[model samples]
Target: MMLREVNTQGETKSGEMIAEMIIECIKEAGHENVVQVVTDNASNCVKACALISAKFPTILWTPCVVHTLNLALKNICAPVHNPRSNEDVYDACYWIKSISEDVTWIKNFIMNHGMRLVMFT
Candidate 1:
């Protein structure tokens, strides 16, 4: 189940609870049957993995390869002069999320375009 944070005057589940739910999912999925839990590189996701590691002690929480690459790219592509710029991080994260969100279609389009190029040649 997804998690939602409640405001001071509101009520909702917290990130910690979300992490616990993710661990519960791993448990419900069964220890021997599951191989990995791949997720984004958000802070909450990281915390979730930590919770899994601490509680489960068996299931592997694999950070997505694409997410790792995005992190590496973020560090490398950060503005040289503006080290503390949030805009750069936001733009990079937005594009990365977009690409991952529609990865299957993007791959298909690239393949189709590549075939068309071969036909033209």
Candidate 2:
């Protein structure tokens, strides 16, 4: 559950700033009530989690698995605009490209049709 949303739209999101925001949320939620903190493995987030862990020894810090896997998939499914090198990598792992295309088609098919989208929802 999200405790609160802070409007830090233009603020610099350094590790320290991120840590302070997370710490505030944790304090508001009650430190003892928070057993774990999960965040994506960005440099700032990693540093923030480290700071939070140091401050609250009892709280476990874990990298977000979904975010990690999405990072891995990004290279295969959505690489930079270098077709030759990307095609070479995709050829080596053909199934990855095929599955990604299939998934995109499936998503579009479902989303384009209101009836289909409603069924899933």
Candidate 3:
């Protein structure tokens, strides 16, 4: 079910504020029906979950799976360094980064050149 959509223009996006917003939503939606709350793995969001857990002991707070997977992929694909030398080390997911860069370059190339874009279309 859709909950409140905060403006957050002049207000702070702190953990306390986020927790309060979540609690308000749960209360409005009938807390008894709420089994879990899911959010991204941001530090503030994690802290908000902790606060929410304290308020409603029965409710479980979980991180979004897609965000978690994106974090995992980012960590895995990030370039590493050898302890001995300045050489760069890459993992199996490195190819994904390469392909992404190539695609970006191709997109830019096509966008910048009107003739290439016309022919491709």
Candidate 4:
């Protein structure tokens, strides 16, 4: 379903084609009991959702939770960072995520901060 990025071997078409493909797959399946199709909140996914809704008429198409989290993170931090600065928001997010995933580092941080850790952010 990942239709982005391709070589000159005619591997893909425009974004619209991806949308059409989703619809085609649903129709091809011939299943009348489909409930929903969950997708990321990308523009292409939006287009695909629209197409599927128009065709299915009864099925719900919604954004994935992971994509929503990424969008929320971007919206909350993108404006606070300087676009011209070398310190990118994405890098900061990755650093925070990486450190949080490390149990020892998190325990040390929590121990150093004590009760103040709750208000550290």
Error of 2 at 9 (Å): 2.2
Per-residue lDDT of model 3, residues 1-121, tens digit only: 6565667998778999999999999999888999999999999999999999999999999899978976655554554533332224354456777665676688789789879646543
Q: Against the true structure, what is every candidate's RMSD?
A: 11.4, 5.2, 8.5, 12.8
lDDT of each: 0.65, 0.83, 0.79, 0.65
Order by TM-score, highest first: 2, 3, 4, 1
Which of 1 and 2 is ahead in lDDT? 2
TM-score of each model, in listed order: 0.48, 0.69, 0.65, 0.51
Worst 10 residues of 1 by lDDT: 1-10
Q: lDDT tens string, model 2, 1-121?
A: 6676677899888889999999999999999999999989999999999999999999998999978876677676665644545667766776786777787798789779889745544
Candidate 3: RMSD to truth: 8.5
- The global Cα lDDT (0 to 1) of model 1 is 0.65
Model 4, range 36-66, lDDT digits (tens) per residue? 7888877877887887787788879889997
lDDT of 3 at 14: 90
What is candidate 3's CA lDDT for residue 38? 96
Among these predicted structures, which one has the highest TM-score?
Answer: 2
**1-121, model 1: which lDDT tens digit per residue?**
3232233345344558657667666667676766667778777777877877777677788878987886665554554545666775666566665455486577679877857566544
Clashing residue pairs in all predictions, respectively, total 0, 0, 0, 0
